[model samples]
Target: MDINIRRAVIHNVSENNQDQLRDTIVDAMQKGEEKYLPGLGVLFEVIWQNADEQEKGMMLDTLENGLKQT
Candidate 1:
């Protein structure tokens, strides 16, 4: 059984609108289930690929700050 997680995740959410995407993310996070992590990673990959340099920098800064809280 060959499961392409990234492809599956992307396919699942490909037609989602902004609000639906937000709901998916929020639900995943609130549930804190390991199964949802791959989907979140795929979403992050899409965001990273589409982001500008400044946006990437901001994401990095936010990540850095988030790490400090842990």
Candidate 2:
């Protein structure tokens, strides 16, 4: 069986509004299930692709800080 996880994740969330997307993310985080990680990765991929240089830098900085904290 071939499963395209990225495509599946994007398809599932594509129609969601901002608040709904927030709910999806927050719900996934609160659940803390391993299954949700790929979905989150897909979301991050979309964000990273769309972000400009400054936004990417900020995201990278935040991610670095988070990694250090953990």
Best by TM-score: 1
lDDT of 2 by residue, 9-45 (tens): 9999899999999999999999999999999999999
Where does model 1 exceed 4 Å of error?
A: none
> Residues 1-70, candidate 1, lDDT per residue (tens digit)?
9999999998999999999999999999999999889889999999999999999999999999999999
Report RMSD (Å) for each prediction in the order shown.
Answer: 0.7, 0.8
Alpha carbon lDDT at 59, candidate 1 = 100
Residue runs of model 2 more than 4 Å from their true location after superposition: none
Instruction: Report the C-alpha displacement of residue 54, candidate 2, in angstroms.
Output: 0.6
TM-scores of the candidates in the order shown? 0.95, 0.93
Give candidate 2's whole-model lDDT. 0.96
lDDT score at residue 48, model 1, on the 0-100 scale = 100
